[model samples]
Target: MLTLHPNSNQDVVDQSLPVNFQDFIKSEFHDMKQDLTSISKDITSLRQELQDIRIAMGFINDEHNKINEKIAKMESKFKAFDALVTTVEHLRTVNEKLEADCNAKDQWARRSNIEICGIPEKKGENLLRITEEIAKKAGFDLKMTEIDFVTRVSSTNKVNKPKPIVVRLQSRYRKDDFLACLRKLKVICQDLGFAKNESRIYFNDHLTKFNKMLLQRAKVLAKERTYKYVWVRNCTIMVRQNDTSPVIHIANVDDLKKIK
Candidate 1:
């Protein structure tokens, strides 16, 4: 039988091989277990971050939608306001056009002569004083006929009558003051009971309908708007002309004072 030769090199190799093999298996398995645990933790953290990102994105989207709705509502309101502004501007233009047209057509009427009597105020006790002065200067009589006039007693103008007059009185004067003036005129007529006719007093709220001259005079006298005035008809002169003394002219409050 042939015997195998055992050298020193073979003996050392045999002893080291078993120990190195055991150490390699133990180290590899421990490293593999630690790597798996680290990978699991990383995956869990990534999932949590993804959930947080989705929640933040949803909030951002909701805010964007709310902002958009508010912008739309504001746009609608602005459109309505713009339409209203356009209508008002159109109406203003129309009003201005109409006023211009009226002014063009009524030029003569606007510039007509307006004579305000009882103006250029001369201070006096009553209307008779002014009428007498004007009559003396104008070469006319301050006398009135004892007959009824064509116009009513409350007629604002005695324009055609001789020495026509306008009167004004303080608005604060007592009701009794007006009554007293009328009573005085009536009493005068009673004294002249032999006369054919007498004077009459009339009252009306507005006098503009009967006479433009009277209205203008009233406006002139009402410089500070503190007084009121009116008109009256009367008989101041009793002259015989035709069969039963033709009526020459009518009288005013101022002229009637001298009737008796």
Candidate 2:
């Protein structure tokens, strides 16, 4: 037999090794199995992320289209509402002016009127005579003709508390005299045989219906603001927080806001 001579080269040494290609392939199979498992997991995660992105992108596109459509619809309304808003604003302004003018007329009508409280109501009392008597007691001369109207405030039902009397005199001078004489309310109550508790009477200028409501609300606000007293003078409601505090005249609802 002829012996093969080995070439002294790197390739020759590699081929002369005891490890064969089949052994190498078998050793790599276990390592390749682990690598394939990791690769498969990576591919599954990538697919899932891609699917999530596709769904999110579709939702975002749909919402964006919806918003664009809504904006287009509202854009049309902007122009259409301009004229309507102007008309409404004009009507609101006119209404305020008319209301103010009407209130002025109402206040003027009540210029010579006076409101009296704590006057006990009698079943068949002569209200006119009682008013004249009250005027006389106040150190004033009042005739039956000088009085324009006299009546007690009406109520739906009879109440334990008497309804106040509203007396309308013919002249503003007579009304002033009536009010001035009311300052000596104590002496009048004593002469009239009224009890001490019943002596706490109130006399004030008759207020218009609107101002009456304003005064009621202002009184409540005054109490909340720690005012010592709320009283009316010359038909205007005034509030004092304490004895030394400056008087605050509440002419309307707007005046109440300054209290806070």
> lDDT for every model?
0.40, 0.77
Clashes of each: 1, 0
For residues 33-143, could you state the per-residue lDDT of candidate 2 as single tens digits?
779888999999999999999999999999999999999989888867997899999999899778868987888788898888777777888888777777777767778
lDDT tens readout by residue for model 1, 139-231 = 443243311111212334466532223333223132223323433432222232325434432222222332333334433433334333222
Deviation (Å) of 182 in candidate 2: 1.4
- Tell me model 2's lDDT, rounded to 2 decimals: 0.77
121 Cα displacement, candidate 2 (Å):
3.0
Model 1 worst lDDT window (10 residues) = 110-119
Q: Which stretches of candidate 1 lie over 4 Å from their true place?
A: 1-29, 102-108, 113-260
Q: Estimate candidate 2's RMSD in Å.
A: 8.1
RMSD of each: 21.1, 8.1
Worst 10 residues of 2 by lDDT: 8-17
